[model samples]
Every structure is written in C-alpha cells, then in structure tokens.
Target: MLTSTGKLLSMGGKPRNKSLSLPFLMNISNTASKQMTKLRTLQIGNVDVIGSRFNGQELHSALCAEGFDSHHLVWRKMGSDAKTTEIDYPFKTPMNNALKKLESDLSIQSILHPAPFAIALNEHFRAADLVHYHLLHTGWFSLLGLPLLTKNKPSIMTLHDPWSMTGHCSYPRSCDRWMTGCGDCPDLEVIQLMKKDNTHGMWKAKRDVFAKANLEIVVASKWMLEKVQTSPIFSHFKHHLIPFGIDLEKFRPGDSEVARKKLGIYPGNTVICLRATVSPFKGLPYIYEALEKLSTTKPLTILTLEDKQLFKDYLGKHQLIDLGWLEDSNLIAEAYRAADIFLMPSTAEAFGVMAIEAMASGKPTIVFEGTSLPEVTFAPKGAIAVPMGDSDALTESLRRLIENKELRNSIGKEARQLAEAHYNWKTHVSRIIELYEQVMSEKATKANR
Candidate 1:
C-alpha cells in the first residue's frame, strides 16, 4: 500500500499557518514520521559509479544504503559514437558493462527533448511516493526531462554549482555577466558565435520552469546558499544547505613513514600535496609559482593527481612527483598521511571534499579564504586561509608550514578531530534522509489540500 506521512500531517489538523520556515519544517519532519506512515522514495540522477568526476555516484550510494528505492537513469544519444566506458580502474564489474550498453541505446538528442524522456520518467514517477533530483544545468537529462518529472511528483533539486543560476554553466569570476544577465559571453567567441541577447529571456524561461515545479533547492555550501539567496532566478524556491560527507574509515590517518615509503618520498622530506584533476579554476598556476619561489631552498616534493603529460608540460623539468589518479582509498589516505601540508587554492569551489579528506588523513590544509573552501576548512587553527589569487600569501603560508613542524602537527590533529566530529558519512546521510522525509511530508499535505 502507498502511504505518505505528509498526507497524515495535512489531515491531522490545520496549523495556524501553512507556511513553515526551514527549521520548523525540519522539526516537523523529524517528529512527524514517527507518528505517521512510511513512504517509498524515488531518486533521479545520472549515477555512473565508475565515472569518478560526478557527485551522482556518492549521492546514489548514500541513498541506496538508507533503503530508498533508488533508480538511476542515464540518457545519451543512440547510434552515437560517444564512448561510455568505466574510467580506467582496477575493479570493473558486470553492472558497469550493462550501464554502458544502456547508455549506448539512449540518444542524446532524444534525452534533450521533453516529450519522450518525460514519458519514460513519468512511468517511474507514478510509482514513487517522493522524488529527488540531482541537477546539472547543461545536461540533456536536466534540461529536457526535469520539468516533466516534476509535474506529477513532489521534487527537490540539488544544485552542485552556480551554472543554473547564470546563463553560463560556470563563472569563476566576473559576476557582472550573470548579474546583468549573460549576453556577449567571453566563451561565445571561442565557439565562433556572434554576440547573442537572450540573457534575461533565457534565465527567465529556465527560472519559470523550475519555480512552477513546487520544488525546493539544496546547496552543498553556505557560500552557495548565500549566492542562491541573492540570485533573482533562485530566490523564490525553498532553500536548504547540506554539505558532502567523506568515508572516514578509508580516509583516516595512516602511518606517515609507511605512506612516504610507498609513494617513494625520502623518509624526512617535507611533502606538500595538492589532489585535483588539472583545470584552470583549480589554481594550479599559483601553486606552480609558489613552488618555484621555494623549490631551491626547501627539500620539498610536490605531488598531484593530474595527466602525466600536462603536469610535465606545466612543470618543465621541475622535480615533482606525479601520481596519476589513485582510486584506492588506502593509497589516497597514505598520500595524505605522507604529506606535511595539503594545498587547495581553487578560485571557485562549491565544497572542498578533498580538503576534508586530507583533514581526515590528519594533514593541515592551506586554502583560499574567499569561497566555499573557508566554509569547508572552517578556518581551523592548523589551516591557513590566504586571500584568494594572492601568490605571495600562498608562498608565505607554504613556507610557514614547511618551517614549523609543531604547528603543522597541531593543526593536523585538530583537522582530524573536526572531520571525525562533523564530516563523517553516517552523520551527513542521516541529515539528508531527514530533509527528504520533510519535503515528502510537505508535498503530501499540499496534495491532500
């Protein structure tokens, strides 16, 4: 039998007012479910576990573990040459092959059109007691199918970045483009397109579709939450903040000496690590500049997970170690343990998952102060949050960590404690379930009315 807690709340009695604030709604959800009936949940997203770049894998894993009827949907163009292969990793499974086959049959253009994908998604939505969406703005799945899915169900959308709010998929700086509305885009010329003028029109159409869906917005960081609050496109939707959690058992501190040996770092050499796929937004250039200034004086080894060719091209015979894509959790933990300091100077970040992972591995982190990095690090005593894009501050902070062993150790210990207390997967997943229940209940009540 299909039962909804939200329906019961609506029937139980009328409140003084129907409008409830987030805290009140949360309180009601936490308390309401115990007295009411349970409902089946449906989660929607592009969850390719083998594809390491997307957040969908983590979210789907967490949801399934919490006992939701999580159905992953992948939409790609049929007869297309796009290769949908599991990233080159050791543990390839039958499920990966199946997903690849399914992806092969799906058409990208068909996925981008509302009618067909909507018809397919509606079959699942009809069975679901509640719906959740993990949205990526530029994707065919989100652009075409989301409106159709939301029409029949109570839905919530999680925004991973500021792309949807602006016309551009991502804007690291220069808020002016998004603020005034996106026309005459800097990226457009690269595509050999002339200046276009649908900035306000495009966003309004997108915003209207999203706003009409009776959906709520979820952001991963307070920084993002603040931006959403200020944005004209997103201000109307109900907003919530939920940060990503790390698997502590895998990421926790390991033996530093053992880790150093495995990574081939000398026993006592100070190791500074930055773990990210190479991208301009990641501030690799700043780190390279900082390294050049300190390299001659300090016996330091810089390590990163980047393409070997790209790293070599960037460094140009500079003595640096490249560990391409370490997927093994233990090896990643060991890499963190082996490091004396972790550096992340990203110009734009939604949340610093890597920073928390490094913290769990008992390493002090150096991060840029302005964006979501500060929110993740929380300005821990061991962490040094330098002004964003300031190479000199980064250099100074790097030198300080290199010089002061006691300070590094002290901060690293605090960072580990913080991760254990707040950033564990168990705590995070529990909170998410609570929000899911609340949203579901509220939807049911509205339906009953």
Candidate 2:
C-alpha cells in the first residue's frame, strides 16, 4: 500500500530528522515550490487515445483536471468528441506517400505512414519536458518518430496492446513468432493477407527502431507485462505495470429490474451482455457457441453492443437486443446493470476495459483464463474465468449462475469491491503522477549534470 512518497512521509513521521529540517522550510517547499520550479508540461502523443471513448480517456481527462498541462498529439483526430486538445500533423513527405502505397499493396499494418515533420515540430520537441506515447500504429506515427521523441525528452510509451512489441498484428494470439522474429506467420494470409511474407522484415524494422530509441514502458495489465517482457526489442527498457482505471461514481451498481425494464427485458429472463467490438481476437463467436448449448427455463436475452447481424447466423433461437456501439458511458453502465451476467470470451485481450466496466457496474463477469481478462477482473473472486475457447465451461457457469441467485449476488458484491479496490480512476491517475514525478526527477538530474 505504501509507495516511495509514502515511505518519505513514513520516515518523516518518526523523530529522526535531517539537521536542515525546519517548519519554515517545509512551508516554503509546499507553498512557493510551484513558483520556484519552471512550468512543467508533458506532451502526450498517440494515434487516438485522447478524443474518443477509448480506454485511455479517463486517465487523460483526470490528468488534465489535476492541473497537468497536457497536450495530445494525434493523427486525424479519430474521435474529436472526447475532451482533449488534439494537435495533428498536417504535412506529408514523398517517403510517407511511398509507405502509404506500400501498406496498401502489401496489406501490411501501418508500417511507416506518417513521416515526422522534424523541422515543423522542432518547437514542440524542444518545449516538451516529457513525452507519453500511446498507440502509434494508426498511420499518424511511425517507427522513425521514436528517435525524435526520445532524443531530448524522456519518453514513456504505454503498452496498450502488443503491437508495439510485435511485427504486424496488434494482438498476436498464441503467435510466439513475434518474440523470435516474426517469420512464417501462423496466420500469414489471414493476418497479413500477402502473397509474399514480409513479417521477418517487419519484425526487424521494429527491433531496429527500439534499438534506436530510448523509451520507458508502462504495461496496463500483468498479462501484458509478461508478454512484452519476452520481446528482445523491449527487454532493455524500464517497465512498469499500471492497470487502466474507471470512473466509479458513473459505473456503480443500479437496480437490475429497473435496468432490465429500461432495456425491455421481460421478467424471469436471464440477461447476458456481450460488449466486444468487431475484432476476430475479441471472440464473439464463443458467446454464440455457449448460447447454442444453453437450454434455459428462463427466457435468455443477449444484449450485444455490436451489430446484431454479426450474430444473426447463430443467435437465431434466442432473443437478441442490439444497442449498436454505444458512445454514452451511462447507457453502457445501465446495460451492464441490467444484465445478470457479462460475457467476455475473448481469446486475446490486452486489458479488457469492457470487462472492467461491467465489473464496475457490480455485474458478475465471465472471461477466458488466458490473456489479460483473468488478471484484470481478478478471477474466481471478482469474476468467473473459464478455459480459453471452452464454451461448454462458459455455458455451465452461466447455467449455474442462473440457477443460483445467491451466488450471483455474492459475486456481484465482490466485483464492486474489486472495482473500488483497484480500478478507480483516482488510483490510476495518482500512479501516473508518481511516474511523472520519476520522469521529472531524471530530467532534472540529467540537466544538473
């Protein structure tokens, strides 16, 4: 529970003090410290974490509210609706055009789309005290930008997904090729969609980039930390584990019956909510497979955040309610509250923010054993985690929960407790502040030298 700052206070609590310690000195340290120190700001660059319903929004907003002078450097401003200033790079180079054509021709992930306007962005680079880089595969940032970002300021890159460490795919599902050097990709055509394999070249390019840039890594989950540590590219950097946090007040428990009524679910119906976006790795099919096995006495209404047509082929028998990609967090929270159980059968999830949102709403969530879901939700206590791709286990778990109301209530209580204990936005932002302090200290130390 105690941090380094806490240890400082703990040491201060005792009688042993420095010879220079004085009440007057302490007041000056607290009061006039801000004026004494030059204005400090962290320049945050990302593809699209700022102005969107993305997982990083809460942390970004919280930092801004805490008087942190933060600016978001984005590409195209994908979601300009969320609260944040998105400064986009408008210039393009011939190399950028060539890379764009190459990306289309090779069916590669954004390899080197946006060429950095070094001359144009010189002022930004010089003024920034620190750089916090989020997702960079969005055609806005390139492997080349790493050198520029790390040249002057301390750069912290948050590992939101495995893309930073991998060759091509964002979530390399069971593919260890990324570790050794991604070649002969298991799903070559499926993932890369190329006649000729370029995974080796891709992996080598990223490895070279990491070698060129000095970056501090922050993993959002323990699972992510383990996976990223295996990469030779990132092995040499400083790594920290910091889970994504949620707004507790907005996502708290509400009346299930009221929520169910609002969502138009009839009484005696067991509701299951699936909020997976349209990604193959998200594993939406597992939910459908599980549903095919369940023959419940209670009417089963499956609430899907995605398009209903995605499940139309399989969910033929059951009642399906599609909210169709919610932008409002309140509505999403209501849907979570309305559901008796939340289903996240993802084969590969980095942090599972949807699962966190569901748990924060006091719902008993179900996820696969592998990947970050189990660790993020605190399995067996906060949520039920089954073996990966085991729809039968998921079906049985759902059946047991539906049959036993007491078990559901107890788990829901534990889930809410887990949300408070770990996933609160306040806790996440405080840790970020700690990291920022560490970065500033290093910067000051280097400057003094």
The candidate that achieves the highest TM-score relative to the unseen native structure:
2
lDDT of 2 at 1: 18
Q: Cα lDDT for residue 25, model 1?
A: 31
- Show the colliding residue pairs in model 2: none
lDDT of 2: 0.70
Q: List per-prediction Cα lDDT, in the order shown.
A: 0.63, 0.70
Query: For this target, which candidate reaches the highest lDDT against the unseen true structure?
Result: 2
Model 1, CA-based lDDT: 0.63
C-alpha RMSD of each candidate structure in angstroms? 8.5, 5.4
Clashing pairs in 1: 6-441, 76-106, 76-107, 76-108, 77-106, 77-107, 77-108, 78-106, 78-107
Which ranges in model 1 have alpha carbons more than 4 Å from their true place? 1-38, 50-54, 76-123, 142-144, 186-201, 313-319, 380-382
TM-scores of all models?
Answer: 0.78, 0.85
lDDT tens digits by residue: candidate 2, 1-449: 12211233111244224421434222222322342234344444444433243434555555556565555555444666344445544554455567767875775655565545542275544676766776666654567667766877678888778876766777788778888998887776543344567778778888888898887787778687777667888877777776767788889898889988888887878888886466777777787778778867877777888565666654556677888867777898889888888888888888988888888888898889888898889999999999999989999998988888888889988999988878776656655665666667787988899
